[model samples]
Target: MALGMLKKKRDSKMSTDQENENEQNGNQQNGNQQNGNGEDKEKQGGGPPKPVGFLDPRMKHVRRSVAGKWLLTTVVLMIFILGVLSIYWACLFHVDQNLSSLVVYVVDFDGQVAPYNTSGVTPLVGPMITDMARSMVASNEPTLGWGPLPPSAFDYDPIKVRQAVYDFDAWAAIIINPNATALLYSAVQNGNTSYDPLGALQLVYIDSRDDTIWYDFMAPFMSSFMTNAQSSIGSAWTRQILQAASTNTTLLSNIAAVPQALSPAIGFSEYNLRPFYPYQVIPAVTVGLIYLIILSFFSFAFYLPVWMQYLKPEGHPPLKFHQLVVVRWCGTILAYLFLSLAYSLISLAFQINFSGGNPVSSSTEVTSTVDGNLNPDAYGKGTFPVYWMLNFVGMIALGLACENVAMVVGQPWTGLWLIFWVITNVSTSFYDITIEPRFYYWGYAWPLHSVVEGSRHILFGLHSRIGLDFGILIAWAAVNTALFPFAFMFMMYKNKHHLHEYWA
Candidate 1:
C-alpha cells in the first residue's frame, strides 16, 4: 500500500508540471503574433510602401482624394496661363494693325494769301497749310489721319487754340501767325533777325501725354516741313536779290510776279500742352501697386474667416453678414488711406510736387506777337485733391466689388478669376480704349480705367471726364454693396444644404 501510494503521488506531480509547461508555450506564441501585427501596422501607416514615381501606387485614389484635386488644379492653371498669354499677344497685334486709323486735328492759323497776288483771291494762308497737311496725311505710307478744323472753330486766338486742345477737339494745334509770310520774307531778303526762325516760328501745341504721337509723328513731319520750307524760301529770296542787284528789271519783275512761290516759309514753335511730368513713372507704378494690394486684401479677407473658424473653434460665433460688410468697408477705407499716404511720400521722393489753383491761363488772348502766344502749360494745382479723391473712391469701389465677387462665388478659386480680370484690363494702360480692339473696348467700363483717366486728367490736365467716371464708380460700389447681403444668404443656404452631409 505504501509503494502504491508513493507511485500515485509521483504521477500527479508529473501531470501538474506538464500542464504548466504547456501554458507557458501558448503564452509565448500569442506574444509573437501580437508583435508581428504591430510591426505590420507601422510599416503600412508610416513608411513608403512602394517605389516613388509620378504617383504613389498604394493609396486609395492615388493616396487621397486631394491628389485628384491637385492634378486638376495644375492642369487648369496651365490652361489659364496659356490663355492669358494668347490674349496679351492679341492685344499687341491689334494695336499694330490699327495704328493708321488714329485721327488728329489741324488748326491753320498761318493764313496769308501772299503780297502782290494777281487772281483777286483771299490771301488766307490757312488753306495752304490745310492743303499741305491733307496731302501728307492722305498718303498710303501709314501716316496719321488729319482733320482740318473750320475757321469757325476758333477766331485766330492762341488761348482758344490751347483750350481747344484741352477740350480734346484735336490732338494738336498748328498756329500760323498773321504776319508769318511777312516775317519770313523780311528774314530772307533783308536778313532781319527779328523773325527768329525758332522764336517767331509757326506754333504747334501738342499733348505730350503720349510720347508716341509727338516723337513718332509730329516731330519728324514738322522737322522735315520746316527744313523744306526754309530751303525753298531762302533760294527764292536769293534769286530775287541777285536779279535786283544786276539791275535786271525784267527778271526782277518776273520774280516779283511769282512772289507766292516763297509761300513755303519756315518758322515754327511747339508747346507741350500736358508736359510729361518727370515722375510719371511714380503715378503709374503707384496705381499698379495699389491695385495689387487691394487684390491681396480682398483675397485674404475672404479666406480669413475660414481660417479663424478652424483655428479658434471656441473663440467666437460665426460673424454675421452685416458685421462682415461693416468690417470690409472699414478695412478698405483704412487700407486705401494708408496706401495713398505712402504713394504721396513716394511722389515727393521723385520730386513730384502738387499745388492748388487754376491750371488754365487767366487770359484767353491769341496774339501774333512773339510774347503773346498762349501758355501751353500744365495745371496741377487744385486738381490734385480731386484726382486723389477720385482714385481713393475708385479703389474702394474696386475692392468692394472684388470682395463681393468672392462672396458670391463662394470658392477660393474666385481669387484667380479676379486676377485674370485685372490683367486683362491692363490694355487701358498704354492705349486709349477708343483705339483698342473691340475685345478690349470693354475696358471703358472697367473701374480701373476710370481711375486712370481721372488721374491723367488732374495730373496732366487732360480733357477730364471725372464726373462720368465718379458716377460709374459710385454705381458699382452701391450695386456691389447691396449684393453682399444676398451673397451671405446664399452661402448660408449652401452650407446648410450641401455641407450638412459632411457634418453629419
Candidate 2:
C-alpha cells in the first residue's frame, strides 16, 4: 500500500512538470512571431530597397555587364525605331495630299496676231487666228484663260519679261514675235531644213536660276507639256505620211521608211520629269548623319579608356593581347550596330524617301513610272537583300576605319569632334557653290562623301560618276582591318611600362 502511493505521487509530479515546459515553449514561439512581424513592418516602412552603388557587393553583378548594357541599348533603340516609323508614315501621307497643289507657269512666245477685216486680211483670218490661239491654250485641262493683248503688249522690251520673272508675277512668259507664222510658212515652203515648226510658239522658258522654287514649279508642268507635244508631233507626222502616200504606192512605202514630216527615225517613247527631291535630299542628309554617328561612336570608344583609367587610379592591369584585341573588335561591332540602327530609325521617322524597299518587311514594289512606259520591275520583290548586305559590310568597314583612326589619334574624343566639324563645314560649303569645279578633287579626298556616294550607287544605282569611290571605300576597309592588329600590338607595346609597374 505504501509503494503504490509513492508511485502515484511521482507520476503526478512528472505530469505537472511536463505541462510547465509546454507553456514555456509556447510563450517563446509567440515572442518569435512578434519579433518577425516587427521586422517585416520595419522593412515596409523603410520603403523599397535602394539601388546598390558601384562599389557595393550587390552591384558586383550589375556594373559593366554585357547583358545589362545590351538590354538597355536595345530598349532605347526600339523606342527610337518606333518613333522613326511613325514619322515615315506621316510624311508619306503628307506628300500624297500636297503634291497636286504645286504651281506651274506657262509662257507663249508665238506672235500670231488676230486678223482684222479693215486691215485688208480675209474675214476667215480672224477666226483662224482665234481658233489656233484657243486650241493651243485649250490643250491643257482646267483651261486657265486666254485673251488678246494690245500691240503695246509686245513693245519689244526685254525689261518687262525680266522683271516679271524676278517678281514671280509670271512662272513663265511667251513673247511671240509678230512675224513668227510668216517665218514658219516661208521656211517650210523654201525647204529650209532649219525651220522650227512650233517656231518658239511653245518655247517653254523657265527661271532655271531660281533652282529651289523653279524646279518645283517646272517639273510637273514640263512633264505635262512634253506629253502633249509628243502626241501632237506623232499625230501630225502620221497624217502627213498618209496624205503623201495616197498619190503613189511606191512613194508611200518609201515615205513610210523616211517620212517627209518626221525626219527622225526614232521617236521619244517616254520622259519623266518628276523631280526626285526626296531621293536627292534624303541621301545628302543621311550622309551627314552617318558622319555624325561615326564620330560620336569614336568619341565614346575613346572615352572608355579614360573612364576605366579613372576607375583604376593605380593603372589598370594590362589585359592579355588577344583579350584586348577581342574587346576592341567587339566594341567596334557594337558601336556599328548601334549607329546603323539609329540612322535607320531616324531616316524612317523623318520620312526621308529611300529608293530601296523595307529590309524588315521585305516589301519591294516597282513604284517608278517614266512618262507612260512601264519599266521592267528591276527592284527586288522583297526587302533588297543584296543592297542591305552590301550596305552592312560597307558600313562596318567604314566604322572600323573610324575606330582605328581614333585610336591612332590618341585623343579620339577631340580628334573625332574636330574632324566632324571640319568635314561638315566643307561639305556644306561645297554643296552651296553652284559650280563645283573642285568636286573631283575634294570628293576623292573625303571618305564620307566617297562612302555615301558609293553606297548610293550600290543600293539605289545613283551617283556612280565618282570613279574611285568604290575602290577607295574597299581600300579604307582593308587598311583599317590590317591596322587593327597593329593597333593592338602598339597599345601593348606602349602600355608595357604600366604593366611592369603594376606587376612589380
Candidate 3:
C-alpha cells in the first residue's frame, strides 16, 4: 500500500510538470507567431531551385544525368542543322557562276548570205550584234551561254526564232533582223518617219517560266547587255553615216534628213512569250507551297488520334497491322485530295483565270504585250482538276516520305526531319534547278521539283512537262508505297516489343 501511494504521488507530480511544459511550449509558439511563424528550416521550400555550381557535390548523379541530356540535345541539333540542312545552301552555291546552264540564243540574220537579207547593203547590223554578243562569252563576267545560232539554224525566219523561245529550247533569243541594215540605210536616205528602231532587234523571253529567276538574275543582266550594246552600235553607226556623208554630197543631205537617227539608233523589241500576269499567283507556287509539306506532315498529328482509335486495344478489336497501314495510306491520300482542293480554291477565289483563254492559233501569237494576249492555260478548262491532282500527288510524294521518316526517326527527331525536308524541297523546287549547282541535279527527281514544274505548266503555261512531272511524282509515291509497309512494320515492332513506352 505504501509503495502504490508513492507511485501515485510521483505520477501526479510528473503529469503536473508535463502540463507546465506544454503551457510553456504554447507561450513560446504564440511569441513565435509575432515573428511570422514557428516554422522549421525546411517549410520555407529551401529557396526555390538553386543554380547548382559546377563543382557542387550534392545531387552529382542527377546533375550529370541532366547535363548528359542537354549535351545530347545540343550536339544532335547542331549536327543535324549544320550537317543535314547545309545541303540546301550547298544547292545554291555557285549559281551565278553556273548561269551558263541558262542558254540564251543570239541569232544574226543581218546580210549573212540569207534569203532574209535581200538588202544590197553589206550585213553591218547582224555582224555588229553577233560580235557584241559573242564578245560577252569571251569576257570574264558571268553571263548566260550566248549560243549564237546562224540564221540558217532557224531557216532564216525571225518568226521561227520566236517559236524557239516558246519551245523552251532557249531561255531567250536576241535576234538581229536580216533587213536591219537595209532599213536603217533607207531611213537615213529617205528620212522615213515610220522607221521604228524597235524593229531592228527582238529580245524574246518568257517571264512566266520562272519569274524569280527572270526578274532577279536574267532580266537585270540582259537589260545591262542590251543597254551597253545599244550605246556601242549607236556610236559605230554614227561613224558609218559620217563616212558615207563624206563620200557624196547627196549622202550628206541624207544625214541631215535623218538627223534623228544619230541619237537613238536602235532599240530592242522585247516579247515575253508567256507572261506571269497575275501577281496573286506568286504565293501559290512559291513560299505558300511550303505549307503543303507542313499540312501533310502535321496531318499525322492532327488526325493521329482518330486513326489511333482503331489501333487501340480498348472497345473494338485492334485493326490488323496491314489494315492499319492501308488505312493510313488511304486516309492520308483522301485527306490530301480534299486539302489540295482547298489549297487550289484559294487561287481560284482570287480569280486566277482557270478558264482556258483563246488558244494561240500559232506559236508566234504568244506575247506579254496587251494586244488581247490572254494568259492561256495549258490544260484549258481542265487546269483546276490537273492542279488539284498535282497537289494530291505532291502531298503523297512528300507526306508519305514524312510518314516513313517519322516512323523511322520517331518524335523530337521528326521535327528535325521536317526542317530537312522543307529546306531541300524549297531549295530545289521553288528555285530553278537549272541555274543551281550540279549537286542539285538530283533535285530534278525530287517530288517538290516535279510538283512545281507541273504547277507552272498548268498555271503559267510555261512547259508541258506534266506527263513527266506526274510520272516522277507517281514514282515517288509508288516507291514510298513499296517501303510503307516496312516502315510501319518497324513502328509496330517497336510498339509490340515495348520499345517506345508512355508516349500517349
Candidate 4:
C-alpha cells in the first residue's frame, strides 16, 4: 500500500509540471504572433486590424512577382501617351489639301442669257470670272471646288442662287448680275452718276455654319480671288475706254463725265446668309459640349456606390446577374433623364435663343441682309424638349462607354481610358470633318461628333441632320448596353477570385 501511494504522488507532481510548461509555451506563442508582419495585429482603441507595409519580409514574394507587372504598366502608359494624343495632333495636318470639299458655285446670269442681252453686247465680266475658275480646276494650286455652272443651273434667277446657298446646296455662290456689263456701258455712255458698283457681282456665304472654315479658310481665299479679278477687270476696262475715246471724240467728253465708273467698275457684294451672332451661343454649341461629356463621365463615378449597393444584400437576398444588369440600365437611363435636363437648362438660363428665325418671304432678301439672317434658332417653342432629349441620349452614349471601360479596366487604367476617350472625341467632333483628311472619316460614327453636330443644328438654326445625330447616339447606347452585362460579369469574377487584388 505504501509503494502504491508513493507512485500516485509522483504521477500527480509530474502532471502539474507538464501543465505549467504548456502554459509557458502558450504565452511565448501569443507574444510571437503579436510581433509578426502579416499576422493579425490587435488595435489599441478597438479599431480594425491594419495591414503591414509592402517592404515587410512576409511580402517578399509579392514584391518580386509584381516587378514585371510594374514594367508592363510603365511601357503601356508611354504607348498610350503617344497613341491617344497623336489622334488629335494629326487631325488638321494638310487641311489645306482638302480645300476642294468647299464647293463654291460660280454662275453667270449677266448678258450670256436671254432678256439681259438686248444690246447684243458681249458680257465681259461673266465670262472673265467663270473662265478664271475653270482654268484653276486643272492646276495643282489649292482651290475651292470652283464649279462654274451656267445660269441655267440656278434657273437663270439670282434669287434661286441665294436660296441654294441657304439650303446648304453649296458652300458659296459668286453670281454675276444680269446688268453687270449693261450698267458699266450705260454709265460710261450716258454719264450716269447713279452707277452702283456692288450690283455687278454677288458673293453669298453663311459664316455660322463653321467659323473656323469660314474665317480661316474660305474668307481669305475669296478675298484674294475677288481682289485679283477686280484689278484685272479695271485695267482691261481702262484700256478699252481709252481706245474708244481715240475713235470717237464724243466718248472723250463722256469719259470726263463718268470717269469714276472706269476705275473700280465692279465690286463684290458679300452676302453672309447666316452670321454667327449673339456670341453667347458659342459655348452652348462648342466648349460647353465638352463639359457635357465630362459631366456624363463623372456621373458614373457618382452613381457607382448607389449601384454597388444592389450588389450587396443587407436585408434581402442577392440580386440575379441579369436583374442587376436591368437595374443598371434602367437606373442609368433614369439618372441621365434628370441630368440632361439640368444640362439643357444651363443653356436656357443663359438665355440662348430657342426661337426659330423669321422665314424669308423672298429668298433674294437674304442677299440684302445686313447682319445675315437675324434672330435664327432651330425649333422655336419645342426646342427645349428636343435639346433635352439630345443631351440625354448623348450622355447615355458617352457615359455608358465610360462605365463599361471602367468596369473592365478599373482605377488607374480607367484614367487612361478617359484621356483616350476625350482626345479621340474632341479631335473628331470640334473640327469640320469635311476639311479633315480621309483618315478621320471613321470619326463620323463617334458619339461626340453626333452631339456636336446636333447641338449646332439646335443652337444656330443650321441644317437639320438631327435624325442622323440621334440615330448614332442611340446606336452607341445600344452597343454599350449590350456590353454592360459582360463587363459586369468580368468585374464580379475578378471580385470573387481576387484577380484585381494583384495590382489594385
Candidate 5:
C-alpha cells in the first residue's frame, strides 16, 4: 500500500512540470508574433526610408562600392567641366579661329556669252574675282575659299538659292548678274560719270538667329570676305578704267578728272531672307521656346513612371511593366503636344509670325534686288498650323529619346539631365560647330539639330530637307521605343538576380 501511494505522487508531479513548460513556450511565441507585426507596420506605414546624402535608398549598393562611387564622382565632375568648357569657352575660341576654312559659293552668272564691247574687249571679270580670293589665302588672314558653281546654277531661281544656303553648303552666295560687266562698260563708253551704272552688289545672306553667335558664324566670315573683296575690286577697277580713259580723252575727262565721283563702281546691298517681325528678335525666341518644350517633355517622361509607382494606392491594381511603357509614350506625346499648342496659341495672340508672310494675303509684293525682277506673286502662302503640328511631333521624338536614355542608365533624372547638357553644348544654339576643331559634326545626326534646322526652313520658305528631318526624328523615336522595353527587362533581370548588388 505504501509503494502504490509513492508512485501516484511522482506521476502527478511530472505532469504539472510538463504543463508549465508548454504554457511558457506558447506565451513566448505570441510575444514574438506581436513584435514582428510592430516592425512590419513601422516599415509599411512610415513612408520612404531616409536618403543617404544625395542618393536614394535604392542606390545603396552603388554608394557602398568604391569603384561605383569613383565612377559617379568622375562622371559628375566630367559633365560639369566639359559642358561649361564646350558651351562657353571652346565655342568662342572656335568661332574666332576657324572662320578661314569656310567656303563661299561664288555663282558668277555675270559671264557674257560674247564680248560686252565692239572693241573686241572681253570683261575678264570672273578671273579677276577668282584671283582676289586666291590672294586672300596667300595673305594668311582668315579668308574664304571660293567654290564656283556650274553655269547652269545661274538658272536656279531665288528659292533654289535660298535652299542652297539652308543646306549649309555655303556661308554666303554671290550671284553675279549679267549687268556686272555690260553696264560698267556702257557707263565708260557713254562717258557718263553721273552715278554708278553697274548697280548695287547684292549680297544674299541669312541673318543671325541668335544675338551672340551671328548666324552660325556667317556674319564674321562674310564680313571679312566682303571687306577684302571690295578693296580688291576697287583697286582693279580703278586700274582698268584709268587705262581705258588714258586711251580715250573723252572718257578720261569725264571720269578720271572728277575725283569726287571716284567711288566704288558697285554699291553694296545686303538682302536678308529672314527679316524680323518689325523690331523683335524672335528667330531665337522660336528656338528657345522649342527647346523649352523638349525640356518639359523630358521632365514629364522621366518622372511619370516613378511617380506612378510611389503614389499608387495599395488596393489599386498593380500596373504592369508594359502598361507603364504605354503610359510613358502616350503621356510624353500628350505633354509635348499640349506644350507646343500652348506656345502656338501665345504666338498667335501676339501676332508673332514665324513664317514670314503678310497677315492679309498669301502673296506679298517683293522686289528682287539680284535680278531686278518685279512680281506681285513673290511670297508663298503662310502655313502656321502645319508648323505647329510638326513641332509637336518633334517634341515627342525628343522626349522618347530622353526616356530611352533614362531606362538604359536605370536612373531617369540623372541620365536625362546629363544628356540635355551634352546636347546643348553640341547644338549650334550657343556656337557653330563648323568653327570647332576637326569640324566636329557628330551632333548633326541628333534629333535636336534636325528640329532646329527644319524649324528655320519652316520659318523661312526653304523646304530643302524638311522630309529628311522628320524621317530622322521618326527613326530615332522608333529606335528609342524599341530600346526601352529591352532596357527595362534587362534592369529587372539584374535586380531579381541581385547582379547589380555589388555596383548597381
Candidate 6:
C-alpha cells in the first residue's frame, strides 16, 4: 500500500512539471509572434530608406516658397525703373539746357596778321580767339553744376586734353591754323573772280561725350565762334577787294571788265547745323529698352539654375544641363523681343519728337521744312528696327555669356559686379562734362553709345554713318558669344563633382 502511494505522488509531480513546461513554451511562442508583428508594423510604417546626403526638409520648404520669385522680380523691376529714370533725367533737363555749350576750346590758328612775325601775330591771335571763346561763354551764361571734376575749366594739351576728353572736360577743341584762314581769304578772293568760294577748314572738334550742363554752355559758344569766324573771313576778303580797287588802277579795270568777278558772291550759307547733343530721344529710348531687356534676360537666366535644382535629381540626368542652358537662352531671347517691341510701341504712341520726325514712317522726308536741310537723322527708318532686333539678339547672347560666367565663378552675385561695372563705364555722369577731357573715348567705346548712335542713324534715314557704330556693337556681341560656350564648358567641368554628389 505504501509503494503504490509513492508511485502516485511521483506521477503527480511529473504531470505538473509537464504542464508548466507546456505553458512556458506557449508563452515563448506568443512573445515571438508579438515581436514578429511589431517588426512588420515597423517595416510598414517606416517607408523605403532614404538615400544618403538628402537635402534638409526645411531647406526644401524654403526652396518651394513663392517669396524668392517675388523678391527677385521686385529687385529686377526696381533696377529697370532706376535705369529709365536716369535716362529721362539725362534727356529732358540736362541734355537740352546744356546743348549750347557743347564745344569750349576754339583755337583759331587762322587769323589776319601784318606779316611773317608769328611772335606778334601769336599774341593778337591768341587773345582774339580767347576773346571769341570768352564772348561765347558770356553769351550762353551757363550755371555751374556737379561732376567728377569742377565745371567750366579747359584742358589744352592733347594728352591732357585727351585725358580730359575721357574725363568729360571740353567737348571739342577747334584748332584753326592761319593757313586755313589764308585759304579762306584766297578762296573768297578767287570767288570774286569766279562764282564759288570753295575752301574746307579743318575744324578739330574734340567732343566731350558727356551730356551735361557744360555742353549747354559749350554749344552756343561754338555756334557763335563758327559764325563769327566765317563772317570775319568774308569781311576780310571784301576789305582786300575794295583796297585793291581803290589803290590799283589796273586791278579796278580788271574788276570792272569782268562782270563775273565784280558780281557779289553770296557768303557762307549755313545749312543743317549739327544738333548740340548727339543723342536724341528715339535712340535714347531704344537704348533704355535695350538695357531693360538685357537686364530682364539676365534676371531670367539667373533664375534658371535655381529652378533647375528642383527638376534635376539624382545622377546627372541625360541632356538635362544642355536643356536647361538652351531653355534659359531661349526664354531670354523671347523676353527680350517682347520687351523691345513693347518699348517701341510705347515710344511711337507717345509721339515723342525724336527730332527726325515720326519713327513709324518709311518714306518720311529726311529734312525738316523750317530747317530746309537734311535733319540729323537720329534713326534711319528701317535701320532702327533692324538695330533693335540685332540688339535683342546680342542681349540674348550676352545673357548666355553672363550665365556661363556666373557658373564659372560659382557665385551668382558676381553678375551684379559685372552689371555695376558696365553701368559705371557706360554712364556719362561719372566723368565730369566740364572738367575732364577724355570722355569722348569712353563715349565712343561704350556699348550703349553705339546702340544710341546707331539707332539714331537708323531711325533718321542716315544709313551712311551707322556702319562703324554697328560694327562695334556686332564685335561686342561676337566676343561675348564666343566666350560663352567656353565659359559654360568650364563651369560644367568645375562643378561636375558636385553633380553626382548632391543629386545622386
Candidate lDDT values, in order: 0.56, 0.44, 0.81, 0.82, 0.56, 0.47
Tell me which of candidates 1 and 4 scores higher on TM-score.
4
Report the lDDT of model 6 for residue 344: 55
> Against the correct fold, how does model 4 do in TM-score?
0.82
List, residue by residue over 1-504, the lDDT tens digit for candidate 5: 899999999999999999999999987886676454444434666765433464655455656896777889889778866865555355445544576555667665454433433445455455555566567667776555556664467453434554565455665666555456656665666656565623525566545333244554556666766677666666777788888777788887667544423456654456554443333325423446445445754575556556457224577745556666576667666777777777556555654444433322211112232332211111243446656766666666676666555555655355545545445534543344666665446656666666665655555444257788788778877887778666655655655633233231
RMSD of 1: 7.8
> Tens digit of lDDT per residue, candidate 3, span 1-504?
999999999999999999999999998886566334323333465544445577766557778999999999999888988987788778768877988888899998777645545656876778887887789899968888889988789887789988888788988999997777777888888877677788888899988889888898788889998998888888999898888878778877766767656657788988877778777788888888999999889987787678778767797766766677788888878988899889889988987767776555355656442565455676778888888899989999998899889888788888988998999888898788888878788899989988888888888777577889999999999998899878877876776733233223
TM-score of 3: 0.85
lDDT of 1: 0.56
Best by lDDT: 4
Task: Report the error of model 2 at residue 292, Å.
Answer: 4.4
lDDT of 3 at 405: 90
User: Taking the tens digit of each residue's C-alpha lDDT, what string does model 4 give over 1-504?
Assistant: 999999999999999999999999998887688666344555644666667798977778889889978999889988988888988898988677889889999999889666667777778888888888887787879888888988887777888988888777888999999989888888888888888778899999887777777888888889988998898888888889889889888778887887677878899998876667667778776778888778877887888888777657698755666777788879988998998999899888877666554564343454222344433567777877898999999999999999899888888788788888888898888788888888999999999999988887776667678999999999999999999988987877876833333221
Best by TM-score: 3
Q: State which candidate, 2 or 6, has the greater TM-score.
A: 6
Q: Give the alpha carbon lDDT tens digit for every residue of 1-504 in model 2.
A: 999999999999999999999999987886687454444444667864444456865455556596788898788667755654443233223332233333322222234343321233222212333354466466654322334233345454433543443333444433343444344333333444554434323322322222333454344554564456545544654565467558758655554434433433112222111223344334433445455435544554565574344225475555554555566676666665555655555544554334434222111121243343221211434223333433444566556655655555555244544454345434422231222232324444445555454444433333233357556656766777778866655554555534343322
Clashes of each: 13, 8, 0, 0, 0, 46
Error of 5 at 270 (Å): 3.0
Indicate the residue-level lDDT of 392 in model 4: 94
TM-scores of the candidates in the order shown: 0.70, 0.38, 0.85, 0.82, 0.66, 0.43
Angstrom error of the Cα, residue 5, model 6: value is 49
Distance (Å) between predicted and true CA of 480, model 4?
1.9
Off by over 4 Å in 2: 1-274, 279-287, 290-299, 302-318, 349-378, 381-394, 420-442, 455-471, 488-504
